[model samples]
Target: MPLSFYGLLEASLLMLNGIAVLNRERFLKKVFSFSSLSHIKFQLIFTRFFSVPLIAINILVILFKLLVG
Candidate 1:
């Protein structure tokens, strides 16, 4: 298996898939049904904090893995 392969996989999956799913209002609504308004707001904020950095880091990791071998 690749070094930090699970890390790479997780970051890429969240970067590619989670962003799209969370970005849609309908999906988010369905996900957090019955939750407080504040909680939903927090999730929106957290998503940005979580997913945005993964793209850059994942790219660097992939490049580093390729170059080091």
Candidate 2:
């Protein structure tokens, strides 16, 4: 409903997805015994590319509300 609620939800999802991407090696080891470490590394790098900006925006929004509201 509110922008703040959506921002929290998006930040949470980004955090969870970042965790999943970072730990994918452990989870995929069973299913793909031959998976390359480089692939997992790439996934982690790519996830961070998007996650950082979104999380930063969320933090900025919270701070803005607190200071200006």
Candidate 3:
């Protein structure tokens, strides 16, 4: 895979992070068909935990690729 694809994936994850952090209600209402607000919030919180680490890992990968190249 190329660095560009990683960049795009990082961008996507950042966008998801923004949506999860900034516009919880609006995004959740339109995107997920959850029966309860609590459930949606829980999912958001859960996703938040993973997304941060993913972003960090992506940054590390990008750096590693640059170094290797």
Candidate 4:
């Protein structure tokens, strides 16, 4: 497998997770909720905030490897 392939996979997973995180209210109402975790909101916020840079970094690294290696 190539770096680009891995990058695509990572980006896809990130997009799925982003969808899940965005629709968390529906998930909680229709599915399940972690009531024990008081910081669930904060965790979701952190995930939404950090995932973009993580995806960007993954793409940049993959491009660098594909171009330079």
Candidate 5:
């Protein structure tokens, strides 16, 4: 089995960012503050969480391929 260079880099950055967010006090506060908002806020929160990373990954992959190939 072969490992992709971009996949490894993406996974590593994601993990590192996830860990950093979890440990940061301001981030934790914002994450918890979402619960106090209305249902619309909750929906927006989840949508952003899933969509932002996906868009980021797509951009990173395109840039990586452009640079490498």
Candidate 6:
């Protein structure tokens, strides 16, 4: 598998784990609905953090493949 695949998988697992732990608090769930809008917010934050670098890496991979193959 590619390095980025591992990175994505790791990040996803970590995010889920964090959500699970964060939602363990009843008050948190009541206030933030840890399973709802906050999830979307987290995804938005994560996408902003990861998408650009991920796209750049994929583009470089494609260029490398094209040059070598």
Clashes (backbone N, CA, C under 3 Å), per candidate, total 0, 0, 0, 0, 0, 0
TM-scores for every candidate against the unseen true structure: 0.46, 0.35, 0.44, 0.43, 0.36, 0.46
Task: Name the runs in model 6 displaced over 4 angstroms.
Answer: 1-34
Off by over 4 Å in 1: 1-34
Q: What is the lDDT of residue 16 in candidate 2?
A: 66
Residue 5 C-alpha lDDT in model 2: 78
lDDT of 2 by residue, 1-69 (tens): 467976687678667656655555566555545548766776667677877876676687678879977
Give candidate 3 regions above 4 Å deviation: 1-22, 65-69
Better of 3 and 6 by TM-score: 6
For model 6, give the 10-residue run with minimal summed lDDT. Answer: 20-29
For all candidates in order, the CA lDDT equals 0.67, 0.68, 0.73, 0.67, 0.64, 0.62
Measured with C-alpha atoms, the lDDT of residue 54 in candidate 3 is 71
Model 1: weakest 10-residue lDDT segment is 16-25
Clash pairs for candidate 4: none
Candidate 3 lands at a TM-score of 0.44
Please write out the lDDT profile of model 6 over residues 1-69, one tens digit for every residue: 467975686566566545544533454546655567777786568667766766666576668769976
| For every candidate, C-alpha RMSD to the true structure in Å | 4.1, 5.0, 4.4, 5.3, 8.7, 9.0
What ranges in model 4 sit over 4 Å off?
Answer: 1-38
lDDT of 4: 0.67
lDDT of 5 by residue, 1-69 (tens): 268985688677777557444643556556655444564575556566766776687688779879987
